[model samples]
Target: MMRYIGSKAATLPAIQSIIETHASGATSLCDPFAGICTVARHFKRLGMRVETGDLLWGSYMFQLATIALNEMPTFDRLTPTLELEASNESCAAILSAAQKVLAWLERSPGRPGFVTAGFSDAEGSGRRFFTQENAARIDAVRVQIAKWRDDGLIDMLEEAYLLACLLDAADRVANTAGTYMAHLKSWSRKALKPLQLRAIPIVNNHAQNCCSRTDARETAKTNVDVLYLDPPYNTRDYSFYYHLPETLVLWDGATPTGKSGVPATRRHQISDFCVRRRASSALDELLGQSSAKFVVIHYAADGLIRHDEILDMLNGRGKAQFADLKVRSYNSRVREADIKAHHRIYWCDSH
Candidate 1:
């Protein structure tokens, strides 16, 4: 998975403990703000039918590859059109088909195209997001995948899986310190490596899971046993931060602007939760629309929406409880090493 800002990967055990204690029998889980689909993947591994939606195309790719897909795509439709090598004896037939496809893509020759023109520093784009060689490779693989989808050589699930693999590979080689708001002034050691596409891990929970690219305002209405909320707590727009990965998802030939090379389409990626004035109201509206037996919210103590305001909103729904876990602050300006900060988890049993 990509290095997301607010991924619950580290806090999975704590979250699972809470869910087990409060919503032990939950058969379905809904995550409207499915950034990287980390939380949804956690529950999906536990055999719950996870429903996830996100505004980011990059996030939706991960959701589609890791959440919605319950089995390794056999690429049966592709076999007739393309010549794929047989899988090794150690690899299962179920997983081998996808492996062969990845191998074929890895051998794709690097071609300088849209990605090279806009994102590679060596190509005179002045953006240090990727090396010219790697950017060209990314361009080649991305365009090939899109062509396959356009020509009906690959299905939606297969296309999503391939795109997700490319996105992760690109992130590994991205010249940034986590977010792509701006690339590093100098190239990082990892950015110099050749781009390689590896088969991503596939999860099979034996449940029918679904994922969509949509606004949380509409997805909040999904009925489920457990509803998890982890909306943005600050004003950093993800579309601006991870726009490069999204370009791989959209494949739109939108011209890049400014020194950052962010897509012009990024202007439409605003979220109400990022604005201090609309943050609380947006969350309130989501809560009002949610129909879940158990609602779990993850928030930072130093968030724009105050602690009391969240408690007030949660309490109004039903019996609400909260637990605080101490963690280091995310602020780079804080010089003090001993300062204590925590993320608060509020759970409600909406009877």
Candidate 2:
């Protein structure tokens, strides 16, 4: 099953192999920072109970949808209704809203101006690329979806999946760079561009699973056989990188406040991921509270977290051994480039 959470999902087979080698009868697996629930879903497929936690709302939704599959309402029955009414309403509302925003942008000055912007010259009088009209339509659909969710017509998981789909679709039509922070240098001279949204089947065959939205450091006391730690490598807060989509889905129409209140610029910011003094304390707290028999932490060589420091912290708590693996080359949307030779996958075991 495709999971919306977890990085280094490509490395899961190796991680699973190690788990099989060390703990054959492990009844449960937990991922503290389960992004897309990739690891949790893999274990769930093998009949092991899975528990996941993430502070981010979107990540929490992904974990709940992926791991808590048993609780989901049957998609077969719901799909037709969703497709005809909810999905259409949502898409239409998004489009309407986006068009409204685009019109506002045309009248606005500075970078927000559209009539005088370079994008005005795209094929088909800019509709071939992206028109203020399309943007409003996208926003209109999203607004409708939000309203439906608020009215209890859709559950959280369903709403989440729908929002994810909309986000993916909007990304295709967005006249911005790969991320929403930057405008596209050239607009697409096309209409009804390709939409790429991952759809979750209404009928999920995966085993029963559950997820919680809480701090990992606090949730480690549950009884489990394996505790998997994949904390943020440096301080790259996912909130900022994916804020555009989040803002759209989670938008209350309230003005943003402080630093996070404003939209980010094209230039990437790296301040959050930098090593901080509190990092050690947080790690120690998590290690101390985990009720699992063994702990496996995934770390990267280029992160603010030092391998020696992590090893020392784990060793101080219980019996520990460290294993390392090289990460395959991968492109990062936030980093906007391919990371060369990023050494990753640290397996720290506590027996």
Candidate 3:
């Protein structure tokens, strides 16, 4: 339910096949631009140690829940506080406790707060990112999460998991397309549905996975057998596309501005890869910093730095090969014909 602009879910099978064919001996992988941690989650299930980093706080939360945590959080301290019944099966007990918390949150009455005041049409804000009721619910849940963290009721992993749940739930009812660049003038069918928080499946790979908030250039240097890079494809800034989730996680109460109702501070989260002039240079810098024995990169054929240029760059590091995965083009203007595009994956063993 966590929508993304360039999710690799569809291309994951092909990428994994290519990696297993070429770099089967790899024991660890790092995804510096781990949007939603989809790639990291797959590789983690394959018994590879994972490291993930991203500029967006929401991405970091997903990584924390899906990659970094090796077991379900027991919520041992909070269990007694909630007066929940104990179970002989530890894992089941913990998961049930988490679900109970989520159910309680869902039952809480909605309250108009920061999110409703800024991101909803309530009080004539004019923005329609979410309905007034949903916005108030979002506000109430978000505030409760912060309160839990402050009251020592949840740890970092627990906090991230809850926030990830909220992010996914909120996205389902949002009035935007895949991205939050703009909202529909009229309410969409999906947006009319009530928000429901659900628990995510926590991965237990038994490997020490690391996640952090850092630039790709910096995290690429981490020692790993394989490094996966999925940078921004075009000039569209992800900060703008995903500002709602970013703001929701930070909960800084920053004033929203412009037609999109994004906070002005979101400008700081823009990446160099979104700038045409700096895109190529950013890739080069990240490649140079990476210490991984194998490097796998995903880029669009018509991305800011063309796929040919990306191949050439990879070849310079070592022997390189590529696979072109066909993707359905999302251009609504060209409805007369089925347009398609290629998402190219380049993998190489570093010299």
Q: Locate the minimum summed-lDDT window of 10 residues in model 2.
A: 111-120
User: Each candidate's TM vs. the true structure?
Assistant: 0.93, 0.70, 0.92
The Cα local distance difference test for each model comes to 0.86, 0.57, 0.85
Pairs of residues clashing in candidate 3: none
Residue pairs in clash, model 1: none
Ranked candidates (TM-score, high to low):
1, 3, 2
Better of 2 and 3 by lDDT: 3
**Cα error, candidate 2, residue 85 (Å):** 10
lDDT digits (tens) for residues 11-110 of candidate 1: 8898999999988788999999998889999889888989999999999999999998988888888866765654454453554778888878878799
Tell me the deviation in Å of residue 220 in model 1. 1.6
Model 1 has an lDDT value of: 0.86
